[model samples]
Target: MCSRIEDVITEKARTALLQVLGPLPWLEKAQGEVRPTDQIQLIRPYKGGHELALARWGFVSAGMGTAALKKYAMFNARGETLSESRAFGPAFRTQRCVVPLSAFYEWPTVDGKKRKTRMSRPDGLPLLVAGLWNRCEGSEGTVESCTLVTRPPTSDLLSVHDRMPALLLSKDLETWLHGTPEEAQTAALTSWRTGVLQMQAV
Candidate 1:
């Protein structure tokens, strides 16, 4: 599981987003290593195009009480079960978004010692990870949160980790952001099957 990642919305990453997605709205900063529950930059579908928004890292289930929900970690949702999960199913069909990352960290056992590895694309582009978001109202008020989508690692990454974040390619961005549910699913599956990222020991 991808439990930790580099700061998602670095200036460099913002520049990359601008180049691809074009003139994203300026969002407040939440710098440093990002963990679950932190406010992070998310590029979600907006009135036909995309917009930058800040959302908490974990997906909050509206049906579950606060006590029960606290025990469950909803930071990463399994791609295989997207359509079946109560917290993710509805979000997957409509509230999909992209989690941009400068890099993600993985802890892999190498020999007798576990090593920290940094995962990123070979071409130095930002990693646009597919994700789902939801809005839940509670006694405190309303909260918007998101969860990264994960799938079985590709052949090359199996040795490094069992699962990796589902990524979106440049071509599939439009389909994923605005296409029908079926088309979005197809785009997601294609991304999981074909996306490539490189890992390096930090």
Candidate 2:
């Protein structure tokens, strides 16, 4: 699963997001490494339009305080059991979002030794990773957290890791977020072109 990600949104992806959230006044155009608990960009589907939001990388429960964040790892949600999971089910059903990643970091064990690696699109396009986000009232303030949905790795990617982020095409991004839960599940398991995924030692 992806623990670290580089969100260097390319011009094309920036254009796509801008079309949804128009100007993104508060967005700082962050580039490079984004880890758990960090505020990352996400486009939330609202009633009238999309809201560009800054969401924490890990999902924080409403009943839990800030102290519990360090203890629980809710960064990556399993796609196989999304609907049944307490942490990610609700959000997966209604609060889905897209996570644009330039590349994701992974650790693959080869010959019984683990080595850090990075996965990216061979065409240099951004990976529109499927994700779920929610807002919880915290002691400090409202904490909006998001978790990346993960699925069994494609044949080629299994060599690098056992799982990879659920990446959707640019066209299917919004549909996965606003559509029904069944549609979201179908989108999560959609066949992806494995050849475009390039993995290399970081």
Candidate 3:
């Protein structure tokens, strides 16, 4: 249900950070016009480490450039069914990615109403949520989009929602990003044990 995301970090900062991630061979190829259809932005890691990428709002390739749909799209993919769902199975198995966020917004319902809240790690570290992306063709054109992977909420987050985005730590980034298919599946199912998340009303 993470429909709106605030990417406060500027492009320059993102590029600078990416340079530290790893060698980015694609940066030279990233010349096309960025549109709603072009959802994934690739950044070169600073010193030729692992390249980092970000997904934009979970808008999948098929949904981009469509005029008929008006609803806020599904940005978070449930981890339980990620490998089985038709919409995400293939991407989950192969096109896994890491989504970096300062914080993410979730709505808590009360008495049949909803209120917005922001969730972040207690130490204010960027949350590296696991994601799956796909390149699909639509009537308008081809596009790449991604969905945030989600798991059962930790004890600290259960009061707000039953599920929370799959947040990976810096230590686990490599295995999740470049691990083999089997290793990736194992990583996706394992929850980040440290319930260091903090939330506040927004």
Residues 24-110, candidate 2, lDDT per residue (tens digit)? 544546667788888887777777676777888998877976567778889999988998988777788778887777789988887
Measured on C-alpha atoms, candidate 3 has an lDDT of 0.61
Candidates sorted by TM-score, descending order? 1, 2, 3
| Model 3, span 85-191: residue lDDT tens | 87777776667777666667778886778877787666545566777766677775655566677888777777787777787755667777677756765666674
Q: How much is 175 displaced in model 1, in angstroms? A: 1.6
Q: Flag clash pairs in model 1.
A: none
Error of 2 at 38 (Å): 1.3
**Model 3: per-residue Cα lDDT at residue 176:** 70
Global lDDT scores for all candidate models: 0.80, 0.80, 0.61
Off by over 4 Å in 3: 10-20, 23-56, 59-73, 109-113
Better of 1 and 2 by lDDT: 1
Q: Name the better of 1 and 3 by lDDT.
A: 1
Which stretches of model 2 miss by more than 4 angstroms? Answer: 16-26
Q: Pick by lDDT: which candidate is best?
A: 1
TM-score of each: 0.89, 0.89, 0.70
Ranking by lDDT: 1, 2, 3
Considering summed lDDT, which 10 consecutive residues are worst modelled in model 2? Answer: 20-29
